[model samples]
Target: MKFRHLRNEKGISLLEAMVAFIIFSFGLIGLAPMFSLSIESNVIARDNSFASNLIKETIEEYQGVGSLPSLPFEETEDILWTKPTLSGESTSSESASRTNIFSRTISLEDNSTDASIPNGVVQINVNISWLNLYNKQKNLSSTSYLIES
Candidate 1:
C-alpha cells in the first residue's frame, strides 16, 4: 500500500471574504436612511412638545391676568411669566391686526364655522422652528383650545 498524505486548507478564500464584505456594505447602506428618518422624527416630536408646553404655560398665565400680554413684554412687566418671547428675526411675521382690544389678548381668532360653541374660547398655537443638524429649517405647529370656566 502506498502512503498518501493530505494537506487541509484552513482560512477563508479571498473571493469569499470580498463577497461577505460586499453583502455587509449593502445592508448598511439600506439601513442608513431608516436610521436618519427615525432621528429626524424624534427631533421634530421633541420640538413640538417643547412648543406645546410654552403655549400651555402662556395660556395659563393669560387666564390668571384675564388679559393677553402684548407681543413683547419687559422682564419687570406685570404677569411677565405668561409673556411669549419671539425668537429669531427671520420668523417674525408682519401680519397686522386692529382689534381695538380693551384687554390684552394672545388668543387665536376663530373664523372657521362658529355654530354655537362654548363662550370665551381661546385658541392656543404652539409654533416651533429649528435649524436641524442637516442645516435645514424645520417648523411645526400644533393647535389647541382653552376656555376659562
Candidate 2:
C-alpha cells in the first residue's frame, strides 16, 4: 500500500484579479451612457405628461361652459404653482405669483372646412411650451373641435 499527501494550494493569481477588475470597469463604462440616456428620456416624458394634463384641464373647463367665447379669441398665460416659504408655512398671494417652467396659449378660431361641413364651428388650439433640463426648447400642441349640439 502507498500513501501520498497534497501540498498547499494557492488562490487566484494577481493576473486573474487584474483581468476581473478590467472587465468590471469596462462593464461600468458601457452602462454609463445608458444611465444618462435613461435620465434624459425620463425628463422628456415627465414634461410631456405635464403638458398633456394642462391641455386636458383647459379643455374640460371650456367644455363645462357649454358655449364658446367670442370668435378669434386668444389667451396666453404662464403656469404658476404655490411656492413654500422658508418657514414651511402656506404660500401667500404674492408667493402664488411665481411662474413655473411651462407656458400655455389658447387660441380659438371660428370657421368650418369643406362643403360637407357646416360653418360656425370652433377650432380650439392649445399650445404648451417649455425649456427642458438641457436648456433645449420643447413644445406640445393639442387641437380639438367644438361642434354645436
Candidate 3:
C-alpha cells in the first residue's frame, strides 16, 4: 500500500510538469510570427524613408534648374536603382530599382519644369506606398514648393 501511494504521487508531478511545458511551447510558437513581422515592417519603413528623401532632393534640384525639363521632363535615371518602376523604363532594371514600398510619381503642376508655376514657386509631389506582410497596403505622401533659379 505504501509503494502504491508513492508511485501515484510521483506520476502526478510529472504529468503536471509535462502539461505546463506543452502550453509554454505553444505560446512561444505563437509569438514567433509576430516578432518576425515586426522586424520586417521596421525594415520596410526605413527603406521607404530613404526613398522619400531622395525624391525630395531631386524635386528640389529640378525646381532649382529654373524650370522642369522641356520635353522629357528630366527622365534621367538616378545613379542607384532605388526608384522602382513596373514598366522598367530605365536603361537597366538595376539603375532605377527600389524596394516595393514606393510607387513614386514626380510631377510639376503643369508637368512643366521650364518656369515656375506662379508667385515664383513650383510644385513637387512625392508619393510612397508599401504593402506589409499581411498583404495590407499603406502609403504616405508629401508635397512642397521648389524655387526656380
Candidate 4:
C-alpha cells in the first residue's frame, strides 16, 4: 500500500525545471553590472584613502619641524609613491608602471593678519591631487595651525 502511494505522487516535469533555470539565469544576468560597479566604487574609495593619508603625513612632517621658513611660502611638486611587491622588493620598473603619481602643494601663511588670531600663529595648508582609475582628477586638502612658542 505505501509503495502504491509513493508512485502516485507527482514530481516536477522537465518544463518546470527549465523554467526555474531560466529565471535563475536571468537574475544572475541582471546582477552582472552591479559587480563592475562595486569594483569601481572600491577603487575610488582606495584612491581617496591614499590621498587623505598623504595629506595627513605631509602636514605632520611640516609641523614636526619646530621652525618653518618665512611665511607666505608656497611650493608644488609631483610625488611618486611606490609600494613593494609580493616579494617585498621595489624596482624602478614597478614604480614606473604605477599610475598613482600625485601632485602635492604645501603652503604656509602668517595668521597674524587675522584680527581674531594671535600674532604668533601660522597657517599650514597641504593639498594632494591624483587621478583615479577612471582618469578623473580628485583632490584632498588639510589645514593646520601652529603657534610660535
State which candidate has the highest lDDT. 4
Q: What is the TM-score of each candidate against the true structure?
A: 0.43, 0.70, 0.50, 0.78
In candidate 3, which residue ranges exceed 4 Å CA deviation?
A: 1-12, 59-73, 76-116, 126-142
- Point out where model 4 deviates above 4 Å: 1-8, 82-97, 112-117
Top candidate (TM-score): 4
**lDDT tens digits, residue span 76-118, model 4:** 9998866446665666666666557889999887754456556
Sorted by TM-score, highest first, which candidate order results? 4, 2, 3, 1
Ranking by lDDT: 4, 2, 3, 1
Clashing pairs in 3: 67-113, 68-113, 68-114, 81-95, 81-96, 81-97
The whole-model C-alpha lDDT of candidate 3 against the native structure comes to 0.60
User: If both were scored by TM-score, which would come out higher, candidate 2 or candidate 3?
Assistant: 2
Global lDDT scores for all candidate models: 0.51, 0.77, 0.60, 0.81
Tens-place lDDT per residue, model 2, 1-149, is: 88777665678878999999999999999999999899889867877888899999987778777677777789999986333456655466556343347889998776533333358567778999987766788899998877755
- Whichever of 2 and 4 has more lDDT, that candidate is 4
Candidate 1 vs candidate 4: the TM-score winner is 4
Put down candidate 3 lDDT per residue, 1-149, tens digits, no spaces: 45553344434577788999999999999999999889888867666676677677766666567446543232323232344445646646555234344455565554344454565555766665556445577555677776555
Question: Which pairs of residues clash in candidate 4, taking residues 3 or more apart in a chain or in different chains?
Answer: none
